[model samples]
Target: MDVSYLLILLLVGAFATYFSGDKLASKVALVFALASLGMSVYILNLFNAGQNIDFLSAWITQPKVAFALKGDGLSLAMVLLTSALIPIIIYSSFGNEYKNAKSFYALILFMAFAMTGTFLAADGLLYYIFWELALIPIYFITLIWGNGDAEDRKKAVVKFFIYTFAGSLFMLVAFIYMYQRSKSFLIEDLYAMRLTVKEQTWIFGAFFLAYAIKIPLIPFHTWQAKVYQKAPAVGTMLLSGIMLKMGLYSVIRWQLPIGRFAAIEHKNIFIGLGIAGVIYGSIVALRQNDLKKLLAYSSLAHVGLIAAGAYTLTLDGLRGAVLQMIAHGFVVVGLFLIADIIYRRYQTRTIGEMGGIRQQAPKFTSLFMILVLASVALPSTFNFVGEFTVLFSLSQINMGYAILGGTTIILGAYYMLKMFQQVMLGETNKKAFADVTFNEGFSLVAIVAVLFFFGLYPKPIVDLITPSIEHILTFINRTN
Candidate 1:
């Protein structure tokens, strides 16, 4: 199957849905999403069979840059994720009454196109293009349809754009530096280029800054909470569920390999910062009264642990980080969706204002409880498997770091259970609350089923990624 052909299909679908009447726009979008998923699955099979799908040509003769799109295990995983989640997000929005469904579905499809391109682009410049392209539709989606005061929503959107673009510029600089050194823009060529310790350090710093900001690590994470609070729940789901993984994925795909020596030299610093983020994010979340704000902070804490795992540069560490990335994406999306459901029912996000929800919404309560367990790393949940692997890998480097990082589990449970109890267990409020609708229940059930399925059988993913990670580690070791 031609990857470019699939891309064109998605592009056409977006425009078709855009012009289609609002009454039929959603059905059109759903069809396109399913088609994209089918294409992604086909790509995955081809990738697993070790076939390379090239979509572009050799461009520049002097700098050795070519337009290319290829799917490896990592790219395939991301494509599958994007394809799977877009439809779910669309389905989750079925109950929403939008002013212009045509435009909404179109924007969603365009975003999907850009995200798929980001994962598959084989050239640094092309990847950067897709990376920025992915953000444009989202900006509009949030600005036009987001909650809260319109002025505040605009402010949040601008802040999000500035924060992300600032990081992206630094990443572009790193790419330019590599192109200069390797005389090629192909990622494979960049991986083969060698740099002095000083050069690697500087380049690594720039790349790390970009990814860290996207992951919204501490000190750079101020934009996240406000964005989550202001954006529509669908927008939040895309940002937390699929967009953040791009940052984490880049850390593994480019930064560590390109700056191998520097990464090793500064391992302690990364570990220390990650541990601080783990504690700080959790502490801050403990203080948040809004459910969306709390989940935003919780996401920060979880990604911090993923960053720590990446720095470990061991097989176990990388594997754990990869698994954790997928696990956290699913868990966070489910949690935010639940938050949306609660808000729809109670017309508020404040935990202080919610009570006796479980008495009225048994299905919502059950699903929310399961998601909460996953978030807190309870046994039998996917999060526990990922967290345990990461903690064990951290312990291999430093016992104290492991212990400190592990404290997030206890703090996580404290906040999660407290939030759950407040919303579900207390006396009924004066206002009447509706039970979970079938649509809402189906969405939550799908997410919970995935969480349990992956938790019990993560080996397939682990196996898929092992070869690529092994290849990367080998290159690093050889260079060292």
Candidate 2:
């Protein structure tokens, strides 16, 4: 049982898509994504059977690293989320033909390859390689296929590339320092080493800089909205749907277990930052006239709560954080895809210019409303499960932290429902609007179905990740 099949399936899909010719590239990519999804299902089943699907081989001997890839409950859950979303992402792109279509679809598959690798890599150096690998395709995806003013888009892409790349370099330096001390890049080796509080503090900062920029917490989130607005819808889905979780996943798998002392020491500081982001992002979202920009801020607010939950370092917090990561991944992709729909039909993302869409397209309106509700964490949606667990975890820390963090629900409902009203309600626009094409409708339906299904029965995911959370918490609770 090998977990690398997921990666191989995607990498092969990328190359296959490239040579499949433009006419067939998207279909080929979709098939590849579906294949990856099937492989993920098989891996999940094996996981349930108490099997370990791992692969290891020599990579770079000097670094004492191997091409080690393994799946525990945690990594596979992230992998499954990434796998499930890629097909929907590819399917969503069916309405329009991209220039250099083969290359475009190929890059999408390639990004999946890099991202799946990031989730499963078991060695620090291996993870770093995958981490850097994930950055390249997105730079090209945003730069080559993006929208908006060419100059502004270029600046946004470059800023993102530099900012994330710089953060990765910092993390790599920290890994190298740890490798020097432990003489191995295996995650277990890194975890086994005892560090002083000062040492843990610096390493924590290094990983924090990397993950924060990726999560784009509060002040570090300057790159997010512009990038989301400029990139094509498929690109936006990839970023919001899957790429952002890579950072959150790394925080759990890499940062906390390795730097447990610092995590305990500064838990309150990070938790406060997370709450600030929740309120700040929701308020800013309310002010955005652009639909994509509003969704961008909304994403920031939701992730802020998740990050705060992760910082709590409690079983409930970790459980909720992972659940929220999965829940947010589904809902945001739907919202952004809906924004892209408006952009395609009206040729404007300005919310003011759009109205009465609901009258014109009842089906679209209904689906959009459901996703909006899910985003605001309505009970019975998957998001509600995650949000409740996260808030409960925070309450255990302090009633104040829970109270402040809980504002995102009220604020999320405020901005999201308001945006829904402006975008979907009102009288039919003077200009004509068409209903969703089969392709678009299908993708939205599938995404919505997953949200509703998990919202009702989130027990499967919660159960699967609990043992792994407990495994990680052991180290987090240990003081040197």
Candidate 3:
């Protein structure tokens, strides 16, 4: 039940799939991802049985950082989320053809490997190492395999690489500063340190700079839409689905507690910025004609609220952020997949060119409609639960913030329905509009099934992460 088992399975599977040869790569990758999900379910069961799963070994003794990975309720939830979704991501790609199928699927597994590490790392240096490790595979994945013009994709990819890497440097400086005081990179040791207000402010600034750029609060979000547009469906899914959560997770686990008073002091400022992103992202999304770019902006809007909820630091806000993060991950994957589906069938992503897809494909229309509704936070969907909780929490802080955040409901509905009306419900097009195939339909159905399942009864995940949320709140509330 050690958490390392999950990492081992993923890393080994990456290599195995690579060597399995192109003929067998897709099947091998699918089997590996499914096997990993099966193991993860077992781990979740053990965790629910009130057992701890941890692995530790001496690593970099001079620096006093152990190869430490810990699994508590929070980390386990994220790891579970990553594990559960990888199979779906892999399966969704079954209809597509990648030039270098072996290396492509292998990168997907590698990205999951690094993300799992980031979630489980109990030490700051170790966490940062894993954090940086993640950006590598994704860089290559997008740069080489991305769509659009090669020069345009290269520019977009490089800007993202430089932006995020530069942000990490600030985080490393903060870690080294913390290291100077504690002589260790263990999270607990860093959390236990007593720093002057001046020092806390500096650390907070550095950490916030790093995480904001990733969670991509307003000014820092410049790279998102472009990068998302260029990357292939698989690449886009990896970025939106699980990679973005790394920043939000770090915000709750590392940023808030590490800079408690600073976070509290400037919280409203950051929260305002988050709400602004919600508005800005939504408004911009309204103007986008390209299907993927529209979803990209919509994602920015959705995560904007999630980020605001995290900054609120209320129980409702934090819990809602967690729930919404999971919900949004599933919903966005389905949305992007639908976009790809359209592009594959119609050979165009321009919404203006798409019409009456429902006439040709009722199932695709139904599934697409559900995901769009979920994105807009319609009632009876999992997104509604998270959006309600987050807005309620923000309202408690400032009604103005709630009102601003609430615009997502309106604007999201406007753009999503508008997109749908134009694309799925209109005059029948002369061009053929094919329905989703078995694999594609299965992927979308699986996603919608989870959304409704948790949408109706989220108590399992809600109960599972409650203790961890309490643990997080304790550090944030500490006066020391």
Candidate 3, residues 1-480, lDDT tens digits: the string is: 788899999999999999998878888988888888888888888888878788888899787889889888788889888988889999999888988889999988889999999999998988999999999989999998899899999999999999999998999999998998999888888878898888988999999888888887888999999999999999999999999999999999999888988889999998988999999999999999999999999999999999999999888999999999999999999999999999888888889998988989998999999999999998889999999999999999999999999999999999999999999887987889878999999999999999999999999989988888888898888988
Candidate 2 per-residue lDDT over residues 59-150, each given as its tens digit: 88785788999788899899999999999989998877699999999999999999999999989988998998988889988998999888
lDDT, model 2, position 102 = 95
lDDT-superior candidate, 2 or 3: 2
Q: For model 1, how does the per-residue alpha-carbon lDDT over 237-278 read when each residue is reduced to its tens digit?
A: 999998988888888888888898999999999988888889
User: Residue 189 in candidate 1 has what lDDT?
Assistant: 84
Q: lDDT scores for all predictions? A: 0.87, 0.92, 0.91
Give the TM-score (vs. native) of candidate 3.
0.99
Clash count, one per candidate:
0, 1, 0
Residue 26 C-alpha lDDT in model 1? 89
Candidate maximizing lDDT:
2
Candidate numbers, best lDDT first, in rank order: 2, 3, 1
Model 2, residue 184: C-alpha shift (Å): 0.4
Q: Predicted candidate 2: what Cα RMSD to the true structure?
A: 0.8
The better-scoring model by lDDT among 1 and 2 is 2
